[model samples]
Target: MIIEPRSVAIIGASNDQDSVGYALVKNTMSARCDVFLVNPNHEEIEGKKCYPSVKDIPYEVEAAIIAVPAKVVPDVLKECGEKKVKYVYIISAGFAEAGNVDLQDKLVSIANRYGVKIVGPNCLGLMRPGYVNATFAPYEPKSGGIGFISQSGALVDAMVDMAKESYGFSAIVSVGNSAMLDITDFIEVLDQDEKTKVIAIYMESIKDGREFINVVKKAKKPVVVLKSGKSERGAKTALTHTGKLATDYSVYRGAFRQAGAIEVNTFTELFSVSVLMELVGEVDDMVVVTNAGGGAVLASDYAEKYGVDLIDLRKETIRRLDKVLPEHYSRQNPLDIIGDATSERYWKALDILMKEKYVKSAFVIVTPQLMTDVDNIAMVVAKIKQKYKKPIVCSFIGGSRVKNAIHYL
Candidate 1:
């Protein structure tokens, strides 16, 4: 079953509080996961007595979490197989990445024999807020709505922070090394999850490439991806370690298009797209409002590249804009208010466009100069947003002020 498993086991359990295993245990337990510890060396960890092996554990293991050394992983899985553990998560590093191809092959072989499902051979592990205990860092995420799958362990933690601080998520997991389990597996699983409204993924490659395309194509919810290894070196690292073929980025791009998934460039894009996925009713139409012509021009360029139409203002809309904006600034798709625009102009333009049938989304570009008061503009925009239900995105380009605002908003 690709859904969340109720029971779980932790292999390579440790006594060191500072260790990744310790953190994994702490976070998952915080989420109220039905956790069972298996560490022969320790009598108990964090008040829970440890089992010596998966075989020694009393309950049936639904999922197995491994956090021990890389070399000992096969033996652990062997024990898991003996105990009939269905799912195995390996957080130890040292295989193809350590230039040990044979080791990676052996692990894969062992897993396939017993029909073992693996998450990572060298990684921080999975964390699904909706599922049981996570194997990420010490901090577990509070269950919410969105589901996330990341490739890097560190990035997974970073995204966890963003998920909690920004738009909340349902779960988080890392598909490190992707020996047996992979991005597709999680995507296919989240595909059916009721809690998963939005999916933000950090992936380098997909194992079953064709099936990956099919899953996203069939997915009703939006999938936001920040794919790394766009370059040759990056593609190499993504492929060699995960046992996945890092094909041309163009192929993946085309696949995403065919699958109807939105590809993002940065974490900001990932979150913004997902947030917009909920806030906006339709994505094809957008209105670009800016006081700076250059800023409007750049926004138009971005819109053109994405195939998103930026609509021109209606005649009445132009008349309204002309009452407030400078005479030189034309009433066009960008609706540039020019440099001399007052606070009233900003709010007025927003109100007029918010009512427009063609404008499903709004992009506000602000480049404040000597005459422009950033706070004054933000206040006007925020007020206008409060008035309108349509989703509005603010781009404070060309300054740290906007970057600061971007993060805050």
Candidate 2:
């Protein structure tokens, strides 16, 4: 499986600080696996002895990362096959996407002959949290419930850095070119991983649509997809990017919904929805708690636009809120606590809202007002969030003044 490897060999390991090969070798220094550097030209890289080839290494290698020039990838794969490596990650480019489709096929054929699973031919490598930092990305993500599979290696880098607080990953695979093991294969692998409670993907196109739908439909956890290539021009761009023909956007959209995957339009929505899904399973009935009336109104309108159900508070619940809130406050779904709200006020409101049977989760939107204690409110929200086993997302919608509040959450 891509999530765990006993040992790894950097087939094109190098010492040049500016090259991709250098980054690959440098990033693996912290990998928990046994890492071997391989290069016929170098005696050693980063103080690790460089093996002449995979076959030359004395120990068995589970994963071999091909980082040499595209022309040398076939020979490298041959060495990996002879060495009996189970998994391979090809970081070299100039394959199918670069008008070298035959060369890409040859690489795939070698892997199939050896019964090896390939992650990529022209993409960033995969990273298993606490196991290996195989990708060229500089940071290693903290282990979490989301398993992210991406077509764009650059997007993977951005997402890994973007993750914080509750949003992190169990594993990340950049299925570039997907010469042998495509998105479907990786999805099937993650679907069975117990650590992964949620699956997120960034895709330009699907390699096998039918298999993809079948696998996703049977997934036990939530699947979140951020698909590109909607417009004619964008589809053409995707072709140039991944060397795969982009299907009609409508077909992909419908298929994703049919397979029970939540298709998102932007990167932000993809991660936001994924975080909420992992944190609060199958929760749709949400309460919007805000200090500003306009913020509440806007949230309510967007909730309807996005097909999110706003739980109508029970009469008894409203009465309880009425006792806790000011006289002018509206005791509705968007429980506006007025502009001069304090942390305790927010605490009492959230405390009551969370108790309602219909309220599964909440969105705490705080528009910074002159009298609003932003930090205190954030503290209260954080405290209340801990007591409940539900999702609570905070939107401290402001500039420099709200930085501390965001940090607290």
Candidate 3:
């Protein structure tokens, strides 16, 4: 079931200052759901009375977070079964990845018998904005339309810290070991979710190749994947990390393409594409407008590299630019307005370009110059964005001077 729980129970709620149990409870304090603490060692934790087990809590919980030791995870799952919790997030480690495959199997079997959906056997848990922040990660992700699933918990931690302000998430999950539920499971659920508009994945290995491909193919929303372990050494490392052999990189790449999903190579590209996919929607083609000649060239190169075609302007479009731009203007696809150009020039050029029937989208590239008003240009771009049906992306290129302008856009 994909329903957000109305109440949650943390099985290993702890009082220790430096423990995952404490982190889970502390982080989830801001959740909208009613939280019940469970730990036999303490009567209370963080001002809430701690119960010995899930069965002992007077109020029934929709979800149970089993954070106890791996050896006792089965017993905790048994108690959760007796209480009839529908969802489980296993935050504890030392299961399959640690060579304790039998224990992990038993844990999944019990949850299955009780009809409980498990998120992880070893993971950092999950975060669903406006509902719960069940992760041990310190920062809470802002609510947005992007849904991210990752195998590496630390990378998720880094993404949460770095992209928290700029990028938002409808849901975020870290799938460790994935004994019961894996990356494809989350993808299937998120694909059907009304809250998610785009899905992003960071996978070291695939759980079920056929199921993963089929789901991605049938998804109505955009799916972006960043698969690690491209090299032989990296594949070996992946096996050691997740206890699952990494699929051949070439086969996975072909599958992603056939599934109509965007496959990115680096973490940087993953976020870049995901943010655009979520906010701007998809564009089959784009045009570039720039004040700096170098920036225009770079944009053109990348546009071609990413298989986005730049539209050729009609003779009438060139005639329109001739009247507004400098006499020496290049008048090409990368419509280069001269260096000392003002916001008014950019506004006029963009207005002309956007009116063309073929220009589906645009990228506004600006470099800091002595006469450049980065902030003013950004303001003009933002306003023009609202006036068009096409998506507009800005590449405000520079260091400290352009930071505010980039943020403004």
Give stretches of model 3 more than 4 Å off: 1-3, 292-297, 304-309, 312-332, 337-344, 368-376, 400-404
Which scores higher on lDDT, 1 or 2?
2
Q: Look at candidate 3 and tell me the lDDT of residue 271.
A: 88
lDDT of 2 by residue, 84-113 (tens): 999999988888888899999999889889
Best by TM-score: 3
Local accuracy of candidate 1 as per-residue lDDT tens digits, 1-409:
4336667888766768778788767766654446788888888988888988889988887888888887788899888888887877788888766677788778889888988877777766656665665565645566766678887888777766666656766667778777777788788788688887778898888877799988887777778888888889988877666655577899888888777777889988887777666555235568888878888888888776555678766788788777866678757888787877656777878887887776777888878767766666778777777777667778877666566555555
TM-score list, all predictions: 0.82, 0.85, 0.88
Pairs that clash in candidate 1: 127-172, 129-171, 146-170
Where does model 1 exceed 4 Å of error?
1-4, 17-19, 69-72, 78-84, 96-116, 129-133, 136-146, 157-168, 243-245, 257-260, 266-282, 312-326, 369-376, 397-409
Tens digits of per-residue lDDT for model 3, 221-278: 8998899998999998987777777878998987786777788889889988999889
In order, what lDDT does every prediction score? 0.75, 0.86, 0.85
Rank all candidate structures by their TM-score, best first, as comma-separated numbers: 3, 2, 1
